[model samples]
Target: MAVTKTPIEDVAGDFHRPAEHDGVALWWLGQAGFLLRHNDLRLAVDPYLSDSLAEKYRGTPFPHRRIMAAPVAAGALTELDFVFCTHSHTDHMDPGTLPDMARASPRCRFVVPAAERMKAMERGVPPDRLILVAAGDVVVLSGNFSAAVVPAAHEERWQDGEGHDFFLGYKFRAGEKAVYHSGDCVPFDDLGDWLGVDSIDVALLPVNGRDARRKANGIPGNFHLLEAIALCRNAAIPLLLGHHFGMFDFNTIEVEAARSEIRSLGASSYAELIQPMTRYDIR
Candidate 1:
C-alpha cells in the first residue's frame, strides 16, 4: 500500500540553528525527533526530516497534517556518537532519515530494542553498528554515559499468538542527570513498576496520547495529554517535554490548550511542559 503523505504544512522546511551548550540541553527537532547535547557527546533520537511524511498524507482528511518544519536537517546535525531508536515505528525508524544520518555521521552507533534488531538491520542500518538491548541491559555508551532499554506497550500491546510487534523506551543517564523517553505506550496496570526509577529530570512524552482507540490507519499512536500528565506526575518528574503535538494541523490538539492542561494538572510546581520550537537547558 502506498503510504499517505502528511499534509503540506507538516513538511514545510525550516531548520533551526543548533544551540551552544555548557552542560546538557535538549532541542525538539519536530514530531518525535530530538537532538540532545552534553559537552562532547551528542545523541539524536528518532530524528525525522520535515518532508518524510508530507507528500503521502497531503489529501488525507483523518491523519494530522505537519505544522512547522523539522527543527534541523540530517546533514545539518552531524558528528553523532549515538542514535537511539525506541522501535520500528516509522516515527523512530524512518527510512528516509536513517540512511542520510548513517552517511552523515559514520561514527555514530545505533542502540535499538533487541527485538527489532532484525527489522532495523533489514533497513540497511548495518549489522555491526547495531546494539540490541532490553530492560536490565545497561549499555555504557561512552565516558561515564549509559542507557537502559525498557519495554513499552506499543499500539499492539496485547497481541497474542505469532502476530505482534514490540516497542522500546529508553532511560538514559549521564552522571547524576537522567531522562526517559516513553516511546509510544499506554498506561499499564503496573506502570510505576515500569519506570523502575523514582524520578526523571526531563520526561519526553506524547501529549497526543494515542492508544488502541483510533481505528483509522496511519493514526499517531501516542499518549493522550492527560495520560502523559499522569505518567509524569506519578513518576514525580519536574519537567515534561511535549512531542507529537503539532506534527499535523487536524489531528493534534492546539498547542495552547495542550499546555494549559499540562499546567493545570497540579504538577506544574514540580513539572513543566514545553512547547515545540523551544529548548531547555538541563543542569
Candidate 2:
C-alpha cells in the first residue's frame, strides 16, 4: 500500500478550525510529532519542523535532510496552550523550532525533562513559561486535561549515568479517554507491568527499529515494527497509531511493509497508519 503524503498547505485550515470534537483530535506532524487538541487547549508534542538538522549535519555522519514540509508555519501558529518535548535531542526538542513556537504562541508553556532545563533556557524559553518534569510527575494542564510522565528507555535506561538528560513518555487524559505517546522508546519486556492492564485508549508508538547502520550513524532507534505490534497487544490498546517515519529519507522504516505485516498478524484493525499532515479525531 502506497502512502498518500498530504501537503502541508492542504490541511493547515484544520488547525485553525474551532475544536470540533468534545473528545480529542490529533494531527500527525511527521517523525515523532503530533498536535493534540482537547477543548480549546491545543498541545504540540515533539514537533521537529525546521531544516536545522540538515544544515548542521551536512558534512557529518547523519546528514539526511528533511523530506517533508512543515504542516503549519511557526509564525502562523497561534493560541497554542502548551508544547511538550520528551528529551534534549535535536529532532525531538529542536532549538530553532522551539524559539519560533515561543514567538508565535507567547502564552504556551513548554514542558520538558527536568535535566534538560539548560537546553530549554538556551532555546530562549523564559523562566515563567517553562515546566520541567521527570518520570512519575503528574502535571495538570487545564481543567479537564492532565499528563502523567512515564520514564522511557531510549536504547538504554534514560538516566544521568547513561549521558541522557531524562527521556520520557506522556500519558495524557482528556475527559474519560486516555492516550499514550511513547516518545522514542524501545519496548522493554516489562512495559506492560509498569503501566498496569488496559490503561491506554490510543497508543502512538515508533516503528523504526534499531539496527547496526543507524547505530553506526550515531542515531538511536525506537521500537521495531513487530515490537510495536506486540506492545499494542499486551497493553490492550484499542487504537494503535505508528509514527516516527517519513521525515528524513536516510532514516525511515518501510511503513507500508510494516502496515502489511500488522494485517498479516491479524492485528490490522488495531493499527492505524496515519500519514503525515493528516488529522484523526479520537472519539
Query: In lDDT terms, which candidate is top?
Result: 2
lDDT of 1 by residue, 146-187 (tens): 777666775545432433336767777767777788777767
Off by over 4 Å in 2: 1-10, 161-165
lDDT of 2 by residue, 1-283 (tens): 1112233544546776888666777788778988888888888999888888888889975686877777777656677889999988888898778888898899999999988888888876777899988877889988878998887878865677534348888999887778899888997766676566536788899887898888777888889878887788877888778888888877787877887888888887778576765667766
Worst 10 residues of 1 by lDDT: 1-10
Error of 1 at 223 (Å): 2.1
lDDT of 2 at 225: 78
| Runs off by more than 4 Å, candidate 1 | 1-22, 56-65, 156-165, 211-213, 218-220
